[model samples]
Target chain A: MDDLTSDVMFEAFGKTLEEVFEASAEGMFSVICDIDKIKPEESLTIEVSAEDEKTLLYEFLSTLLTESEIKGLFLSRFRMKTERKNNQLIMRGNAFGEKMSPEKGGTVVKGVTYYGFKLEKTENGYRAQVAMDI
Target chain B: MKGKLKKLSEYKWLISKELMKDMRADAIIYANKKLLDEVEEAAVQQLTNVACLPGILEPVLGMPDMHWGYGLPMGAVGAFDKENGVISSGCTGYDINCGVHMLKTDLMEDEVKPKIRELVNCLFANVPCGVGAHSKLRLNSRQLDKVLVTGAGWAVENGFGVKEDLNRLEENGCLKGADPAKISSQAMERGAPQLGTLGAGNHFLEVQIVDQIFDTGAAKVFGITEPGQITVMVHCGSRGLGHQVATDYLKIHESAAKKFGIKLPDPQLVCAPATSKEGMDYLAAMKAAANYAFCNRQIIAHWIRESFSQVFGKKWEEMGMDTIYDVAHNICKLEEHTVRGKKQQVYVHRKGSTRAFPPGHPEVPPLYRDIGQPVLIAGSMGTASYILVGTEKAMSDTFGSSCHGAGRSMSRRASLKKFRGEKIKQELEKAGKALRSTHPKILAEEAPDAYKDIDMVIQSVHGAGISKKVARVIPLGVAKG
Candidate 1:
């Protein structure tokens, strides 16, 4: 289902909201590079908030890209927590990865586009989707 | 949507607003019959979607290279009354001022062809690329602000390039409205380490050789001499800083649209009135990002000269490494155009389209006034790219706009599945091109055949007179970012 004219989209699923957030980041990082080979040599923290579940997912993923760029790391592993604060949803997480090199990746993920964005809670789990502008 | 189009001429098709009650204006697509068939109905529908916006002038333009994108289709143009019309971050895209910069060298292809691989390898080392890769040059907040305010001029003042290089760029490489205060600190943080570095995914530096010259007079004006003349092309844009600006403004404009009582036909097309505070802020910040992009290219151009000098064992001046032109494709401009014999200022939004103002236009540099501004249409990696001159037809019809490049015909995932990078590399080598990249999949995703035919796209614009061909150049060596 990775069908975009200039990008690739994917669905990340997990058992809970925190797991879903981590899964979303993982999915995006996988598209950016070979996430399996990315070791957790460095660690960085990320904090973002949005109005609702879907918006929170969007913000969290988009924030991960910026955090990665600003910190200069190829983030792969993630741990996230969600809470309601000031009547809005807040997502705070820690992302871990190693420095980037040519061999570790090829496609440079530009940003997370809302072209096919979604966050749905199903019978068994939560599923998040994003279309990255590579 | 295609059924709604009425063929006005060989290259123009009109989609009457009468077909849709909500459309405030008509939409026109500049494509021939064959090219028209290739255009997606969704993209044409998006044109009509643009027509529904308030203050949208008639005939929202879809260039020959039009393709389906997230919001506005790539290669589309929309002009709105500056005072009454709306400004959209989605319309301008996330990459502010993502553009092409071309340099024409006096050296011939015969001498460079033998050292193509060495040149490409040297280029790969000199230019920092890849995702999350830090640039060699680091800018503090204060210096970064100056970069945003002055654009390429900062680069020139820093000795990255000469003073004459400024005149060859659009807006003299700096827009006056750029105010650093309008942007967020997040943008500054994201932009600090990225200046002068080419980011990956579709960005590339190509060493080219002139294959053909059609308009010799315009070619001479651009310093493009006979066939076999050498040139280098740099394609990139404002990196994370531009994205951060677009991200911040998209949220602000979305709320502002509500505050202003503007009805959004599509959420993706969220915009504020051009004069609204949110809109003005976005405009100022967008200009800053565009300036950042201009400065980025100037630095890349200087590095290109350095790389050539290092490889050729000659100073850049000795090799005639003069910039022909550097122009943006994804941008918005405030321009005055005659509408029904009455001149009015409008905000023209070009998404994956280039400004193609004709000869004698005030914006045209003096050296090129007799001819026109050089419009470099970037083809995909290993394909034929064109150098075109702005024309009067574009002025009268499309708000002085022209096609940007050979738009992608296939999806990235599909291309990666269909074309093996190793095989493509071999084929390009067979055709005398030396290709280099971080990984082979980068090659696969940007496979030359995955893009539409540059020849056909150029023919449509040339035949329509929106832009006329000056010279055609093919890649001899490419270092993909």
Candidate 2:
């Protein structure tokens, strides 16, 4: 459910860690623009490491927003892979979208906020909720 | 314990110290009965949460426009002893030092009305606006460092504004002890290209006409002499740079809180002791971000001058366009205040509030010292903004703080669902407002109907004797991101 104050909330389910991360990323992009209309004309790969899955998810989404601001790109599709090394959670991901033009770029997404931010395991799959500052 | 508020006066309400077992101080709110009814219960809960923060001075306060925020309520103010307090990034909000700067002009409505449309169009073309909008001037790493340390002074040195402009800015346009090294390279990257841009979501530049004057003496001191005189109001902040700094520090505080053994009622309120390395680093980085904002507004002010000159066929100075004052609404400032009859330095966090220092205060510029600080209150689109002066009553009652603006009364989602951008644009046009924006959807989301009545909100603060009304200005044209 969308929070009434200022931020938008996303909740999604997936079977794998990568799937959960990808769903969370998609949910975030939808807050900025209509997801179905985005055409993936280019590809970008992003890698981040954290102590745990929750931190990884936050960094991953925050990185996407930072990249969007710096490179002027609009990302719509997300592909992610996670691996553990030396007790560290490493996430490698590829995001696909086209350069931002007046038609493609939607509302300005400020950044990802930590309010009620989470990634969790469910009975059947995994569920995640991330709040975006818009 | 369930939240229960007791009326202390017509304009003040109190949440007693006994209301919550962990609360270190009572929570006091400034609001009239009508304004109080509009506040959500969740906002009161958050206010109580603030009361529970460590080393909090008694009477955590909320302005008349209080609303629920992630950790602290927007329009919330809290002071803590410098030696024992903790600092939370969430207290300052994501938009560090987000504020408004007002400019007064000698031109009158009759002189500007004919070219209002052209002036607005020129501004829309000159000012970069909207999401991820980039600035034309690119700064190297060294220049960025200078911006972090020098603030609006850097813009003045670059010939953007006169040196006198710095004097009218809050904190004289820069907070000291800002360490560029404290800012992350990634945050610098996000900020480098976004300087001088008006970011999306409620940020705007408006052309206004002074409609009425409440206090002639104060109005005269503020350079507002006649009704129908023209002015400009700019509302924005340090764009991606500030947001990035806040984002980074929130994560740091989350871990710092755990390390310090500070039990947080909410993850968003995670904080560290003020003297700790993490807290000190966050403060330094936050100051750097705040400096970026000061310089950002100064640069935008320069562009606004250019647009005016292009439209009026005269230099901005020749037409008398100069800054009145600039005030930060979302910020944490360390200042000296009297606590229990003893003067002490405290870190005062004002999120969605403005500093309202009274007359003779050393912080008030010498020019306006006798008249008190000018508190600029920006109204919603299609509404009348106000100018108020600070008072001693405010200094004692709310730690020299006042409401920032007419706080949001409706959700953005509900606004989008209920109104069409095009329809809102038409309504504004019909009301004699010239409008330009990067996206039409912003017009719908920021419709005046979506916010509390600014006139009533101002009345509450005025009635409480914290901030006195000086003049009212109605919008003539607006440009938004």
Candidate 3:
């Protein structure tokens, strides 16, 4: 959130781009609900393909958000693996979560925004920033 | 950016196209000295950005509550030629038709004040609140499609409220050409369970007291008769569905803008020409989402009526609880307005601004036509809200638009760090206002101090002859989702 717009931006880092993607998912879910309380009693497969790494991350997050709402769940755990195919980047993963309950309270994010969204290489590993409309 | 702002009046400022080479039209900002000082440079840059867009009219107007938003600023208006102008889902905002609806009652404040806590609690329970809350009424996808087309009339037909509500609503509670087919399955799924639910974040249901009346004639026209009168105001919009529509179209327009060869200075301003197939489809879809919002508020209003009746042990009608007016704060409308004495059709995109059509405007409801459309400007929590009447100047100057609320001055993060929810709740209690919320953090996030002084905002618009104050209301109790 900024003085100008209430666009929620969060940063996460990991050793590889896949880890960065997983962390970004966790960060966004954490904004929606207390992830610590979200029991991973059920797991679902996640597959998304986009033009590039940045769009891949965005689509990955957006897919999770839509799936969560439709399934009446609050997702917390994530694991992702990505591979390039021709001009497209495909990512397949599993999202673990439990049903939505007020006990696990937090804000509801509308969607992931490209605003301030970034994925870049670091000396040690990789980092990503995701902005969302809450 | 500072020197570029030419002071046009005590309450108005302008930025000429000379400040930016690509700008096709001038940009105007309505603000007093105090609000002008808080206007962000980026927000001004946003207006200029809109000015540079294809088919933009003479002047891009930013209301008194203007702040930096996605593409155009929130509380900003960008009028474009109907046939050639561009329509931006990103610029119209994610929460489509997020608006304020005011209801006036015959009861006195003293009658309602004593039972304020019970009333607030009843409203909270009756209205499904919180982000995760589901609708009390579950409808299948087909039934939901009816809501997408009928808007508030769906709720009225389904026994939530009466038919009179449709008459008092903006656009009769439904926009034409709202094709449900344009809506995605994901949006439909998201909207299905959340129709009557009030999602969190600045959205609220409040019981208020009309503390003062600024215009007796206009007040009477809107059923705001006496000072100390009891009223109810709701602030919310289309939920996940609307957000999804915007997200979906933002992606569509991203490609559509490229296909149409429309250059955008910012990605958030991605748009399609109004006459393009993509643009029409997005417009049809946006109108559908907006209609969903209208239905959402209407159902909530019915529940509010029931809550009030239960607490008072009287029929809602007996208390003269009538829908005063419902105004959409975020919308894009195809309307006819006179520009330099020439009547032309234009798409007026009021991102977070309210329509304030002057007296005798054809769009104003028959009951309010003589006095002008009722512009309900919501205040930040625990602040004073004003009921204003539209002016001819608004039609001429701002495309018949006014500010939406006490615009936020600080970010949610800053406010949460600076304020505590429990402390704020206790303060409200001390001030004789009842408050309730699902989450404590939301209270902190929406601390009144985080918002601009709404009084100064009203002053600027009133002084600028855009909207005239009618009545001032203060919350007696609040139920926040």
In model 3, the runs with Cα more than 4 Å from the true position are: A1-4
lDDT of 2 by residue, B116-180 (tens): 88999998888888765668789999999999999999999998899989989888899999999
Question: Of the candidates numbered 1 and 3, which has the greater DockQ value?
Answer: 1
Instruction: Report model 1's interface C-alpha RMSD after superposition on the true interface residues.
Output: 1.5
Ordered by DockQ, highest first, the candidates read: 1, 3, 2
Docking verdict class for candidate 1: medium
Give candidate 2's error at residue B466 in angstroms: 1.2
Looking at model 2, residue B149 earns an lDDT score of 97
Candidate 3: tens digits of C-alpha lDDT, residues A66-133: 88888888889988888889998999989999888755757778878887778998997888987787
TM-scores, all candidates, are: 0.98, 0.97, 0.98
Identify the superior model by lDDT, candidate 1 or candidate 2: 1
Q: Which ten residues in a row are the worst by lDDT in model 3 chain B?
A: B407-416
Least well predicted 10-residue stretch by lDDT in candidate 2 chain A? A100-109
**Candidate 2, B215: how far from true, in Å?**
1.0
Chain B vs. true chain B: TM-score per candidate: 0.99, 0.99, 0.99
Tens digits of lDDT, candidate 3, B1-481:
8567999999989899998889989989999988988878888888888998899997899888988777788889999999878988878978899998889999998898888989999998999888688789898988999999989989999998899888999998999889999999999999999999888888888889998998998898888888889999999999999999998999999999999889897888989999998889999999999999999999999999999999999999999999998999999999999987999999999988999999999999998899999899999888889999899999998999999999888877788789999999999999888999987888898899988999999999999999999999999999886
**RMSD to native, candidate 1:** 1.3
Worst 10 residues of 1 chain B by lDDT: B127-136
